[model samples]
Target: MSKYIPGNQKHLTLNDRIYIENELAKGTTFKDIAAFLCKDPTTISKEVRTHRLSDWYHKGTFYNAKNFCIHRYHCQKTNACGKILLCGIKCASCPTCNQTCKDFEKERCKRLDKAPYVCNGCTKKINHCTIAHKYYYNGRAADRKYRELLISSRSGINMTKHQLHQKDQIISPLIEQGQSPYQILTNHPELDMSVRSMYTYIDKGLLTARNIDLKRQAKFKPRKCHKTQITDRSVFTHRTYSDFCSLDLSSFVEMDTVHSSRESNKTLLTLFFTKEKLFLAFLLNRCTKGAVRLTFDRLEKRLGTYEFISVFENILTDRGSEFGDPVSLETGIQGIQRSSIYYCDPMRSGQKGAIEQAHTMLRMVLPKGTSFEFLTQWDVNLIVNHINSTPREILSGRTPYEVALETLGEDILKAFQLKPIEPDKVNLTPKLIRFNH
Candidate 1:
């Protein structure tokens, strides 16, 4: 048989087994067979030993040996004799041994120690072999066994019932109290469970908390489809994302709005400075284009048009209805341009991702479904001040307030009623507002 060359180091295939059987039939040695298949000799030896099946039969039945031997009782007492005085030989190999002999035992072939362990390479006819033992390797049977083992190894969880219950007792209360798994794990270093496993436990009903209890685990509704055509494409002709990327301007602000439950009419208008990571929030009576425009007019009046132009030289925002009137937003009461406005691509809020990432901190305080009806502008200012004062690794461990203090003058900070919060006292939770009262 021709040698088979292997392409890469992989499991043996059906073709390799067929070639091994053919090589064994030709009286080929394991080392030579291994060389032909590009495998180690020991690998071939182990494969044959592992997958080979053993068969047994009595030789006396075919040989027509007499059953009435006087030594049968002595042979039956001990299948093999330890001394010559008791019995001359083992019963299975003795000529007088038959199926009727109580000491009957199948004999193992001595040839199994030589080259091949199976009958596939034996020169003697299988049916005529006097030795009662035989071994044969079947590729199909070995393949089935391999697949069964692979599946069984991966089908079950490794945790014990007691360990699972302990995890549930620790994690369940925190989840019930409106803490996320990430938050729970962060605060409790000894939990030692992964976030994915916690989620899986909740999903599988292994914990007291269900998926419905998670703030963000609720089923998402499909977004309502709208016409793709821009209502005023002319406004975005020069204000597209491509144009925004080409500009080398150092100062730019991203603007977004946060809304409460549908029953509440109050909302928050958030402004973020990309350079310093400074955040400013204003609570509005309602979310409307007129409200947004009015907020800008007030800021211009408070800081004067020149200072407003200096502070908000460029503004980037999403295509929300509140920001639909970009012309009004960019112009002051005197109809002069105090700042330039740019819109992110429709439905692509990540185009201005910095502001969106900042919202996560806001959500940590006032969770989703919270009504903002009881909140005031002072409360919003407190939240923004705390957020601004928190140190950021991206800013080289400097707080936004520290960076803004050096970059933007005290007048601008005071104009917006923003104050620096103590690093240790900074609080982002709704409790900050409650505790102040």
Candidate 2:
């Protein structure tokens, strides 16, 4: 008689989870990763599929759209929103199409349907692709998620939702103010719970004050601090100046932001096409990452994804924190590929010199210590149009508008309402555009 006895099964440890994460990135198969962890392939499969994060929110990097419909690239349906009669464009190109379109069919990656269900090991997704993309498993995040599930399922100290809310109102504020659990418990005897219970509630996110807020407070138990995870990878991983130099692109654009005086929150986001020396500037309300994203979103909307992808093939910029988030700029919210961003090394603003030269022209009009608060988008457009229409010696006595018309085509220029100004009528002064303020 053959004797086959199964070993005692144990839950996966944090170390095991970390190992799984590393292996998955190396394109290791589930069967191989399972063999090293001394667990069944099914166990690894379940752990990955169940805990794989969508949109990479924990990592601060959202992949292509989470609901990237497979038919988006090829589908010809229109006006899924149904708000307007005879919508101009197809719904497949819209980001919210999947949310409202009745004919939406989610395209699942065939590779994820099998063993390793996450994209950590994906070799094909090197660039900003249009496909619907998601499913990344971070070891620390998976462990945290698993612990929460285990603790919640254990059935200890089951307080009703109402009771939890009442406790949260009192505890969360004190916790936020850096009051230790021990101090709070001793002061508020009416809390009617052990110091450990307060810790548990904060740990499980049952309260408004998070576990992160407890770092400053005196704790009885050893609190292990986990750094906030923005993304599994760095923004400059493959987008350094060296990488930019490696590319033999026919054309490249340099981008930069010009900040106004402290009195005004508004800023100018500028783009200079090196090959043509064509310049475009956008007036932003505040110099923030979100504001920059909004500008990119608006520009992409005006010029469809295909045209945007072609024009902004590669964007070179400085290492400003405002451009820290690149996914939103590179991929449309609907998950379509648009452009790529590369950063120059720190203290190396001269790498993208064309934009620097273009800034000199800008300062001649607005100058330093100027407040952009009074300026409107229309005013900025007028200034840009005038600047683009002026003839330059470097362009062989041709204006940027004239050069752009031949190379980039008039369609993109027209979308932004860029027009020609007679060389005699060209103006580059503070009095160029009339501002409301």
Candidate 3:
């Protein structure tokens, strides 16, 4: 037997129960079992008594008082008890003495009270024992019961329906106003709720809002798988995503074009600097490769080849048709290599995730299917300035305009018509455009 260590506080595990069951079957004393398990004797006693399964059987079917009483069948006691035919004396050995007899009283055993409370380590044969009430300790059954209780205890909320309605009234208006749960909690500390709880309320319809009311709660359709067909193998042979990963560069520019509608030829050419999160938007006259090339040409002419090379050292973009003429994009008008271009995998726009995320801010102001035909370059520049000026938590609460001014210099910002708005005045809705017009 192992020695018991004092002050060891841990729950009894399945292994401990199994060991107790095996030791009990071997007729080991409770003290010995406790020492082997490094637990108190009372703990073992309580465990066996608390978790044991109890059952009752018919008295005549499995129990006989003659086998337990010394008088046996030769005894001549009769009509002393109306309930059962047995000796009137309270026999401690008789199985049904306390159960059937009206005048019977139970006597406690000192051995059962001292250490082992039950018949765990009794050396007598179980079948010959006359005790009608039976108790059994099963490790697997006890473990399953414990697990069920653990799950049931954590299944529901503790708040009342009125309290939930109060929370719903506070959270619904903010959610409808397009403020995220985190933003609401940040702006109003009085609402004592977690972001996850807010989502749960929306999902359960406990509030006036639904899941669709949240901007990001709308589910995205799964991307359909299609066979890979290489129309121009040379376009991707050298400018693959693998080549982009191998380059030892700290900064890379992501470019993508946002279209208004299938019928509209006007689009916005967007470029994002990954490290600083600075966004640049140019309104294109036509959604064609020539317009994209012209935009880059204008940028190079304004920033000059040396400054342009410094800024756009590596450009990573999608395989959109507007970006098809990468050879023209990488070379200047004088036919000099100004930058390197790489293309992401097919249907894998998330490779350049920075720009894709930046488009979300644009969508807040100019939603999908809204025409950009009436929008001019100046309007696009104003929207880009507001977006770039908005502070981001990812940038340690600093706006992209501040970081760009420190890294890309004010001269480049002036050349690209990028400017910062006041932090409090930065608006990312269509109201900014409509009010100004």
Candidate 4:
């Protein structure tokens, strides 16, 4: 803050104002003005000009307005030669011999002494005397505000496959928690999504990769149905899944093995509906006749032997021995005496199309190669219920629960022994379902 004296304004000027310039003419220094004006000594030094001489000022020591203007204009056009045609000349040369005035000005000024040269034939001296400052006016102003877009132009705004995979993992859970992609993107303002990409992520495993949350943690790919079928020498005369050529709903149940980390020593036997696309899973202590028989007994107890056989008129299984002695198991099941289990071809996995399709859905909950040595019967049943309850497009987008209700009526919905409770409430106290490799 500057203090104001009684009547001193910043713009104040008067003919009677202190003559600091006149004092300088008498050899008084700015140190003297600092004491007189009570201002910084630098202020007095700033007000004096080197271009002014005694005669060019008022009272032979103060500034004259006309001379100030003349000095300013002269400084501005100092490079202009007296020749009107040569006002903006690029090279300062004498017209007679093409020699630059800077190189021969000492001798040339003697010859043209009445003109503007400082000395004769002295290039260095003349070079030092010329107003040689070059002015450059940059046209475009510098950008002062810093900014950055998430996607860069040099990369063409395309994300790598790995980055897209990462993004899918992040966005999927938000969608499941009922958050819209638009809302998420609004907050982030950088993640871009197309309608196709959103659907693609949902269709993939992106929605259910986490063990405890709804977030999609990984990208999913559909499991391909193997082209080979199961073959058994003991069932040489038995019919194959190809014998029945119908795509009819409830006609077949696809079967596959869910192994434990216990190598092939223990496994879970999974069954899936062909047309209605329902799932049924059983944990077996061993992949033997007794184990398979016990699994069948449990199915009968849960779904009823009649309803189970009726829903799957035939069982389309792979070549695994866990489904061995179909006729004996059927006889013990106390239903049909004739055999109904059919094996896939020796190398063709596609023959058992129903169960083959089921494997893909099962992978979402229990991934392939997941060991079950420590899983419980209730855990296995919970997984089964989850699969059975999942909605399917083939079933008119109605869940298995809906189709099961439609088929068996609502009265039986609660009656099915395999119905699920909340996932966390599931009590699967690891019962070893062992199997022989």
Candidate 5:
């Protein structure tokens, strides 16, 4: 705790990686880049040295591509090929000079030993420079490599199949009669695997023994869900739920996105006003950061800048990838300050109970296991209008539309295409929604 840290535990994003690549191309120092990124200089150096790609194309270097000796340019030696007669070619220009010469030594760039590890910003005809055993940092390629590593590291079994088969050969048959992994491991000292790993192997069907053979295991309840680290932690800087709590604002809206299916692309972006119990939703073609930002842009254009900010002073949401770019969402099109975006704690959906309740109401009209591919914005608006019209018990028998109208006025409700429906006309059933496609 006494040690001073340069940066938090936040992972470097693609943007940061791209910035590193750009700065490296500009011949920037590691210390300066690290300072700008708020990271330790070692981090920047390691990232470059690790992810930098190598290039060793044939004959790709300055003069004397074939002869790579350090003293080739100034050497006066000739007939190094051990020919009886002079080859007439200077030892420096000979293709086999480095191979045939006795005192030849491999030449390497010493500048790559310390900082600016790559040849990006060399300022010496970089594009046309002969590419030898040189290293370069590419933003997209580095990002791709990092993503592949991140995904592969978390998936698949740790043990090899041969070891797994061997372990299974020892542990399976004993359990065929009626022996738990723990009991079997207690008696067998030769087995190298752990009891928990054996249980997992059985659960994954990798072993002959099954979960049904175990005693008292069937009665155990499922374990509680674990929390995953939030994606793109940089976006949550100064925009955490703790920061939101510090404001103590009475009228904040919770935002979320609802997907249809793994195969379908259409989704719904929802916003729930906690004070009025008012719900608003927009149909999105894709559940992506760009799509969410575009939705906010369209809303601002429709409602105007000042009115949009007045309505959405603060937006509290989860750490989904769709909300990764809070900066774009918080900034208005006209370069003015509009709204503030905050993220809820990971795996804590209950933090935004108002939006969860709104989704529950939403599921009533569009239940699970149904396709939303045919849904249109108008169809979604109809569903939302009906949802807002229905009276909520929490609102003291007042509908969301009524509360919204009383507080935000009829003009504001009209801006969102919300209208009051008669008590008899309000339908919570799935039969109310009509698909366009």
Candidate 6:
């Protein structure tokens, strides 16, 4: 039906399993060619039948040999079945047939990647992953720096919060040598650090508890008072006690004003005993001269004539408008013989230490900046009575009443005394009562 075609094995040689061409060129018939080449008769029959019209075999011989040589060469360069050889069959002389060929055999089932990661068991991670590397390095370094700063900054704190005595025990050595924070930080870089961190360390209980006596180092500056001058002569030093040495005892009574607050509705002007710890406080609607004279007159009338003269000699007051007018106050002390009042130096309050000390007593009952206007006279009376009955170290641990009785003898105590306070009525103080007088 159609032209017969030769197979690809047509290029095979005798050594390459006996090609049908060799048997056919030897004058063998198609049947004999197939038998000798161990191929089917149809294979040989196809090869000869395709060139049946070609009488001359010599013309095709050269091209046929050329093609056969090319085919053999190519076949020699490859493995069996025409696949490129990694190592040829004859390994001795062929350079391309060595073990170093491109297609050399390798172990195909082995692993080729890197090792597993440290976080192998992590639920959200994969083996040999590196996702946490950046975060680990960053967080680890930050935590280290934080700890170093937190611990090292504590060296800068200098103060302690302990008692004064314990503070002396712990800090005397440092204070005795006059150590400054700058010097300390220089010597020990950990100490005397940033001010914020030092305060933080103190708040966190990292510093010693002994209180430090950090002196208010003066900043070189001029005075900052608003009032340029006060022309009150009686508010200065010794003005109130100018004639104290010349006057007899109980003749001079120190007078001073006590305020709760500057804008308080009521005021306190208390009388003082310079010799003893006796005090009398009175409340006033206003700190005016009339209010003071009236309160003093009432006190004078309340005490008997003998006792009144014994306690009231002269009134020593400041330049306050309430007590500055000698004319108004002279009428108040009318029955006293030759009573001479004295004035304190202008703005010199310490000269009237007797009344200043009485102020301290009142501070116990009415603390600093307390509102006297809100308090009753009964409260002031209770404080006065407590101070009178309270035994004081300055009076040989005796109450003011006892001191007066001791000075005047038992006859004075028994005659006009209303009631002698029981020993259990008040607590005695071992320490000296701080009296400005």
The TM-score leader among the candidates is: 5
| Per-residue accuracy of model 1 over 156-187 as CA lDDT, tens digit each | 56788887788788788888899999999999
Residue-pair clashes per prediction, in order, are 0, 3, 0, 30, 0, 24
> In model 4, which range of ten residues has the least summed lDDT?
137-146
TM-score of 1: 0.48
Report every candidate's CA lDDT: 0.78, 0.79, 0.77, 0.50, 0.82, 0.50
Best by lDDT: 5
Tens-digit lDDT string for candidate 4 (307-368): 65665566777677556557655653565642267666676777776676776666665666
lDDT for model 1, please.
0.78
User: What's each prediction's TM-score?
Assistant: 0.48, 0.47, 0.48, 0.40, 0.59, 0.39
Q: How far is 320's C-alpha from truth in model 2 (Å)?
A: 0.8
Angstrom error at residue 58, model 3 = 99
Q: On residues 353-417, what C-alpha lDDT tens digit does candidate 6 reach at each position?
A: 87787777667656666666666765555566666787778878878777766654555334333
lDDT of 5 by residue, 1-437 (tens): 11122123367879899999999988889999988887889999999998999876445443576666778657888788877484666778777787888898777666566777788788766545444567889988998999999999988798888987888888888988688788899998677668888888788888887888787777889996442344677888899889999999989999998878656878899999999999999988777777888888888998999999999999999988778778888899998889999988887899998899889889998997667888888888888988998888888898989899889888778889887778898887788875323
Local error of candidate 5 at 261, Å?
6.9
TM-score of 2: 0.47
**Candidate 3 runs further than 4 Å off:** 1-230
- Model 5, position 434, has a per-residue lDDT of 54
Query: How high is the lDDT of residue 172 in model 6?
Result: 34
